[model samples]
Target: MSDSILDRANKGILGLKPYEPGKPIEETQKELGIQNIIKLASNENPLGISPKALNVISTQKDLNRYPDGNATNFKQKVSEEEGIKTSMITVGNGSNDLIEFVSKCFLSEGDNAIYSQHGFAIYPLAIKSTGASAIKAKAKNWEHDLSLMKELIDKNTKVIFLASPNNPTGTVLESKKIEKFLEDIPSNVAVFVDQAYFEYLEEEKHKVSFNLVENYKNLIISRSFSKAHGLAALRLGYAVSSEEIAEFLNRVRQPFNTNSLALAAGIKAIEDKDHISSSIEINKSGLKKAEEAFNSLGFEYIDSYGNFISFDSQQDSDLSFDFFLKKGIILRSLKVYEMPNHLRVSIGLEEEMNAFIETLHDYKKALDAG
Candidate 1:
């Protein structure tokens, strides 16, 4: 008999746990035999896609031809919009792809990458897959502690992952703090700032300066069309960096990584300013509603700047998750992020958010009686 396949797998692959995505509304409905299920798990745009984006996708006729291998049009549009040269932009299947690309381009066996304790799950996964050490710097107040991150940086450190509105916790680091951190880091090490929820932030709080890319050759800023653009289904994201860094990332990127439909949708989505504004307005209102509901219910939650909030269930998160599922409501359990008593809910339409709040109240009442 042949040796066990596990024995032949890479060392990194052996210890890695696959990413668990939020349950789909349709899947839950089929399993529970319930209709009209509400999903506030994944942080998806509740406003749906812009009509302009839909128009572009509907006119696509060429399915057999390969996508632009270089993603020329998409890059050019983004470059003009962001005031960056086309040479400094690299398109990906999603921002997640860019994260992996950076990891592959720099990390290797014996190298180490640093990230905050409660940072995005993909950071560690991408780093570990490269057979590199994933260093978790202790977070301060559930946010990135730049000083702590600098302390963890050793000679083996090759990359650092920083998410402004960090996932799972929704903690944001101020722009000035990040600027100071960047000034102190060594030039050889690369810093990747993932800004997937950037458009959701209020105008006054748009503290991140993309122009920093021009000054720091090692800084890479990755953004996604999936969130604010309502193009998650299309899966388009891009990275902005110095020409040298972008060239390195492009060298490692697979050709035609983004499909043609996604390319077309992204082009239109970027120009749909009104739709984006509407999405942000809805999210702000929904977030306020959720905060008020959580406060009245006496549930502790993180102060969020993103489109989701991580709240303490005050009970076993798995049990809470199961309860919500049975009630036709889907929320995210934070056990994978090491917060077993915390659950995250994405901001949805007013009616959908109300449904979740009512269901949660019922769950709390039931727990109190028991």
Candidate 2:
């Protein structure tokens, strides 16, 4: 037999499951020979992008120059917007980059990280890539069981990953419970609160993650521009922590991890408060419409704080997902999150939401006929 080049990978790497992204619109359309497809699979902004952001990116004159290594201007802008210090932030290409950086910085082969069952998939993936072990606490009511997480933490546990308004389940951890949990955990173990969907929440509804960051040295809050900011295509995200932690993360971070155009877009996106408000308003309306449709269909859904909702599917979610695809609509099947009978749908524009609901109704009719 010929010598194999693939045999050189680490044993753990061979068994890892590659992240399965939602099917791209172009690829799905090509495969099915259909046009006019509605995509509610990926949690992208249905309003597209801010006009001010597009204008700023189009007039870029410094394509050849390297970006600010420290992301000084971006940090300043974020600090101004969030009432947090520039020293408290570390920018990333996306939040995924920050997650990987945390995994590399804090975890070794014998170390462990705790996350909940049905949590964000990246937690386990990031932990595993560092040759560390993952401990999953069983979810309660499809949400993180903080008590179980506390029970699982040992001396070797270096980090814990929790997402408020968690993906696939659309569950939000209450602020008081999280505060209590943070107080209970030892000071050494870092706790990361992923707030990718923060903007979608109302003022009263937003989790108090950033508020607790200073009180606990081990706390980190990760935010992203991919959702309500309408900058998902630009791949901009950031984390807020103590200055010491930020300094250490910066040491491990790659130079120029974020591109110039993306930086320009993010700066412009943040400055355009009108665009941001409009996006949230649109999401609120879309959420109402989606919830109404789910009720009309007699489907139970998690009342979500984010811009997406996960609902119980009448049939196997994999089959229901296939049905949606055939109808030129796309929804996320939650089999990867261990919910085989549920599908998550991102809040889209009014017309897009109507199309998704109509397509789903058609699937039900077809099932009845059969």
Give the candidate number with the greatest lDDT: 1
Model 1 per-residue lDDT tens digits across residues 1-370: 5979888877876789999899998889899999989888989998899999999989999899999989999988998898889999999998999999999999999999999887899999999999999999988878888998999999999999999788989888777777778899998899999999888777554458779988888899989998889999889999999999999999999998999999989999999999999999888988899899889988999999898999999889999999988999899999888788999999999999889889979988988887
Model 2 off-target regions past 4 Å?
1-7, 203-205
Q: Which segments of candidate 1 are over 4 A away from where they belong?
A: 1-3, 203-206
What are the C-alpha RMSDs, in order, of all predicted structures? 1.3, 1.8
Model 2, span 1-370: residue lDDT tens: 5757667655445667999988899998999999988899889899888999999899988788998888888888999888999999999988888888788889878899999999989999989878899889999998899999999999999999999878878788877888888899998999988889888767564566565778988988898889988988899999999988888888889999998888889999998889989889888988888889889878888888888889888778999899989988889999989888899999999899888888868876876777
Q: What is the TM-score of each candidate against the true structure?
A: 0.98, 0.96
Best by TM-score: 1
- Error at 250, model 1, angstroms: 0.4
Residue 24 of candidate 2: its Cα lDDT? 95
Candidate 2, position 254, lDDT: 94
Give the worst 10-residue stretch by lDDT in candidate 1: 200-209
